[model samples]
Target: SGFLGFVALNSEFPQVNPAGSVLLPLLTGLFGAPVLLISAFSNSSNIPRQERRLAFPSVFAALKGSIAGFFVSIFPGISSGVATVVSSIGERSDRGYIVTMSSANTANAILCFFMLIAAGRTRSGASDALKSLNLVPSFQEIAILSIFSGIVAFLLTIFFGLLIAEKIEKIDGRKLSLSVLVFLTAIVLLLTGLQGLAILLSAIPIGLSTHFLGVRRINCMGCLMVPVMIWYTG
Candidate 1:
């Protein structure tokens, strides 16, 4: 749906203005409707289940995550979403998974700055936006901002972690999922217009297959991966 939305915005095939608003309804219809149905029809499992025993994140986990994140930072078009799936291959524990996810996301952003300095190129939309605004900073400046952002984020996390965590824990899973669907729907509709919605609706089933087949959503990366392979190989 998202890729299709991009196409509708860029291409003149449909003879519509290039706008992201078209993706709104397509996505909302495809994904939102299904989740909404599931949320409404499915009964919550009230029975208590045995908890799976797991260890907290350890030094090895952090190191592994840091390394993986560092590697992902260098790969163009391999977004954090794809990195998460790829990194999950060797990960053993939930804590480890979280560590990888957190590190990948943060490292990707931090590396984008370094990417500007090293490759003299911007690979991310944020970097492009920064370039467009003519606000590109030096490596030293980036380092300082990184430290400041990390400190602030860490402090904020410490301050609000428990309260926010508790509140999130209290939210029903189905309700939360439904809310996400609703939010996506609203965002799609409000931003893309009717055509974007059409594309989104078409893409929903493809996205849902990941869940039904018990596979990682990493395959979604095929959107870029296939074209990339062709671009390089061709």
Candidate 2:
């Protein structure tokens, strides 16, 4: 780990990529392949669509999310997950949680773009890389990028979600879970190398313990959030 950092300290180190990218392959293999496999094997009955209720007011979620997004945007190292917690003060259903958290993440990113333009700050490594290359975008460029981003997000989340919902009834849950678990394991090993892979394997017991002990997984997020709180306070 330090070898790469050391070589890059005084001079640029040779950049190398892992043999295979993790995300697209993982998603397609973990989700797509399993869905197809399960559908091919399982006999399905046509399920009637159930009426889903909106458990919380969309306006309330949006308003609170906007406020939390603005708050987090002002502070470095705070994440959209924190905003999600802040906005979800009341009891919410699964849909409510999804919409609120997704909205918070999108809102936070949009706010970061504004914050960057206003304060000349690089909130992410991608932004820093672009700055390093003198490719800082103008407001017009950001606007166009944002529009395209919104379209892509809409297509992926809504359109793809609809497709998933349609085929979800045909998929075997246990098979799908096992497929995802194996796919994810391979992905971590490939992308992160042996040490990172070892850490992930080591953490499996802790993760299982939490699930068995019925602990809220939010506590795990303290790993990053706790240090950020200390950083800002100090």
* lDDT measured at residue 7 in model 1 versus the true structure, 0 to 100: 52
lDDT of 2 at 174: 59
Candidate 2: stretches off by over 4 Å:
1-57, 112-139, 229-234
For residues 33-143, write the lDDT of model 2, one tens digit per residue. Answer: 434444444565234454433244477677777788778777775657678888877936766666677778777877777677778875443454455556767888888
Residue 224 miss distance in model 1 (angstroms): 1.4
RMSD of candidate 1 to the truth, in angstroms, is 5.3
lDDT of 1 by residue, 16-118 (tens): 3333333235334534565564565578612233334434566666665566667766866466665566666788777778877787777778888788778
Q: Write down the lDDT that model 1 would get.
A: 0.62
Give candidates' CA RMSD values in order: 5.3, 7.8
